[model samples]
Target: MSMFAHTETNARSRLPGGKALGGLLQRLGLGGRGLVIAIPTLWLLLFFLIPFLVVAKISLSEAAIARPPYLPIWEWDDGLLNINLNFGNYLFLLEDPLYLSAYLESIKIAGISTLIALLIGYPMAYLIARSPENQRNILLMLVVLPFWTSFLLRVYAWIGFLKANGIINNFLLWTGIIDEPLIMLQTDFAVYVGIVYSYLPFMILPLYANLVKLDQSYIEASADLGARPVTTFLTVTLPLSASGIIAGCMLVFIPAVGEFVIPALLGGPDTLMIGRVLWDEFFSNRDWPIASAVAIVMLFVLVIPIMMLRKAQAVEEGAS
Candidate 1:
């Protein structure tokens, strides 16, 4: 064969293999993208969606002594779908003063705690953000270093500090500040302390993230125009950090509203949070349907704040 014919033969032989390799690579790329999407979707379906569906189903059910502990609302009868939903669980929540009070008190506690967290966190975050470049990382690390310890351990430690005979009371007594140990443990005061300590970082981190990126030129410009520090903060820094404020407040408030651990551990016997109620109904009373109803109602209550946060974030992104 001539040189040109030999070259043509070699080209034809390689064409199919090249095409196959390209097809394989394309298939792998598509598969990788699909896998990335599938993993999170599957995880949410399993953990969140399915669990919520189960809770919803249970909420519509009736209390029973049977194996699963609740009577099903749906049944198949005569080739038709039969539905028997007992809405009394939801209605009962409205009729019961206990439920109403618990919800209101939870809102109050969460709101107060969030406000306190913001007041405390904003300063800490601002200071951290304004620190020297080399020291900023160390300050941030110190803020987050508490997470290195177990949360349960931290809360337990607070118990030792807040108890009547705890270190704080003893120190105060020794210093002649009081005749006896002041009542601190198992009170609303203790609950607030535990919550603030536990969630302060949540409030600070978001504020820091926002403040660190703030343009210092605005402050300088405001000062140049005869704006006082407080005025500058109110008009410039505060407005710019509104997104962080919203984010931090949401992080603190949402979880605080449904908080079980802190209130259960530190709050008084009269402390009636919705979370504690839900826990009692589920475990103590074994009334799963009522617990589910409470949970569903809580979710409905939270939807408003969640939407507000989403809207704020969207607006911030748009402004940026």
Candidate 2:
């Protein structure tokens, strides 16, 4: 659903060449490839595409708050169908600063958290990638193993650590780091920490995948050419792993933009993200039209970058 909503990426098909391409000519319907292609496509069209179209229609309509509410795109009047698809929901967003600020803050939080995740995750991924062959699998497994447990449980664990009376402060006070427990829990800092911690593995995996493929010869060659370590990194290593970076950024940023769980649980009263706003409107206020409008706006934002990342990956794959 997110993929379809990205508006940023266009789904592309790759065809094999030479004998493989000729084979397609002979057996276009071979095996269950026909169904393999058809079923998911049909499912996406039926479920995702149609639902999104309905939401888009709603976003273009007025916010009708009546019971069993629907903001219709048009109405029947004077024995003719009149198009009343005014952008009231979107216009309201422009008139009010609160909604605009929340959306901007959501993007800022997500972007910064993604950078933080990458900063921490990259060194770990690099270390793991450079480990001995025998130990690498175990290390990689440890990174992924946390996913087997409930995510909610993991976030809940942070509560006990970040809360005012949490164990972390108790230990810190016991050690005399400060006379008082710091105000961490239920703040932006806590939210940032939680997000980075939770999303670290997602950032690490792609980086590891790319790093594992990076030949030491590249570094050796650069060093042998008298390039400084930092110079080599800038000129060679980073550029080579661009695809992985792009992929990881997309994976983290896309979901983080709409994350309600982390902010609602860990964030304080000041945390006003678009995801929370969307949830409030749709479920709490039962303002479906406004909620749908928010969703469309988010979809529009994600469209360009996600598509660019996909295109970059395609180019990288072609080069490989």
Candidate 3:
């Protein structure tokens, strides 16, 4: 036996069930390395894959109010090793214009929010990248500090700051800016602020990491070639930092599409985000089938952007 396999067999012998499995693997010459990989693969299949499959199965079933979900999901007529499925929930999804519009709006909002984060984060990242190493750590820490707080707590804090009788309104009133408090909280403005604040760290870190690795020589080389700042940035800096921009945008945009807390806390009733709608379907209505359909749709919606980001990142990496 190989040293590695021998070592793994000896170690596995100390454990209970592992000894038998390890001996079998040793006989098959897949003792350590294969087991290490197989264990995680099996774990993911059990925990993640099985749950997701269950949800998908439930999504395809008719809406039910009963206590238990069945094995076949659609019809549990057959005792075992049998299944029945339907597409009624997805058809219902097709008929709902409100749900469709919410999905589109969610995409637009996430896209715009990600762009805003990129615009703001890029400069701060650049500054941090250019800073002295000692100072860079401090600046990066400051950028990351807010992330230490609970995400829901941050959204709640926005409520206190943007509410009619809250900090901003009170300050404005005290300064005689208005006769009454502005209705800022539970508005789109509040939603945007909450989204931006919650996701800023995700935006900044990737950009900072990417920008810091970039040599100063490129920028200096462009300057030496008589390229103006704007020209150099457009030609060189932007292209080089393309991966960072893509990374940061994806990190924020994907989650923001499915964001429930910020919208629930900071948005008006009029702002009908899909996340809130999905939440209501599962919790308030107890409609698991429709909820599953919503989840499947959300998953489908997210796949497009994720694919786009992955393609962009791969291209950027290839170019680098």
Candidate 4:
């Protein structure tokens, strides 16, 4: 046997718990592969499933003035167990136009931001992927350089550029492009800019990773077949890179949907988003049950896109 296998067998023999665990796994018709899967399964159970269940429980509870700020769903009275679940929180969300509007606006903003990032990042990624090996690293470094700075600072920096008397306006005035400073700050436009700017790297990196590994022979073959460059790119390159595009868009969209800082800082009062609504319900209003309900609903809303992404990934894998 290999040294690694020998050591593993000896360790299992020496450790009673390991031996018992192995035996149990064997009886259950699981083996080394199951052991590998178990780590992530346990991690998700502990971190994701448990926390989600906790939030779901809270969503079914009533807001309270006491500690934890939510009433328990379960109670014991006269040695009998009683269970109460409040569905009013979800109903309240549906009844409130503000919540619905916020949800719509959040989705709209995130969607637009993701599209913009894809547009900007796709060319950058293509260039990087096609570049000489030595220059590729430098270009990639520049793409990710913003992350080296604090995210808040980067958003704040945009304020300096987007404000009426800020860098952009000043430059436009100096260049005689405009008569006066344009109002860009504290607007949905600024929020879009922030989201696109901050998440561009997320879009670019995935595309670059995908494009770099792409078989150039496909493109060359298309060209040899007398296909025009644009046609080849449209039919061949873009189709192959669909997975990367979806991944990048999802990365940008998912976080952008729940983004608090960008909207809170750059967006005007008119620019209502679900994240702001969630913050208000949780902190400003101290309505834990409502907040939990909003969170749960938002999660459900995100799950649709996540499921679509998973399906696309599965299809891609099957095709490969």
Measured against the true structure, the TM-scores of the candidates, in listed sequence, are: 0.87, 0.85, 0.87, 0.85
TM-score of 4: 0.85
Taken over the whole model, the C-alpha lDDT of each candidate is: 0.91, 0.85, 0.85, 0.92
Judging by lDDT, tell me the better candidate of 3 and 4. 4
- In order, what is each prediction's RMSD in angstroms? 7.0, 10.4, 4.1, 4.1
- Residues 176-237, candidate 3: write the lDDT tens digits: 99999989988877788888889999999988888888888999999999999999989999
User: Tens digits of per-residue lDDT for model 1 on 92-191?
Assistant: 9999999999999999999999999999999999999999999999999998999778888899899999999999999999999999999999999888
Measured with C-alpha atoms, the lDDT of residue 295 in candidate 1 is 100
| Colliding residue pairs in candidate 1 | none
Candidate 4 local Cα displacement, residue 79, angstroms: 1.9
lDDT of 1 at 134: 98
Candidate 3, TM-score vs. the true structure?
0.87
Stretches of candidate 4 above 4 Å error? 1-44, 311-320
Cα deviation of 267, candidate 1, in Å: 0.7
After the best TM-score superposition of candidate 1, give how far the Cα of residue 210 lies from its true spot, in angstroms: 0.8
Candidate 3 overall Cα lDDT vs. reference? 0.85
| lDDT leader | 4
List, residue by residue over 52-164, the lDDT tens digit for candidate 2. Answer: 99898887776665765875567788889988876888888778887899989999999999999988988899899999999999999999998778888888889999998
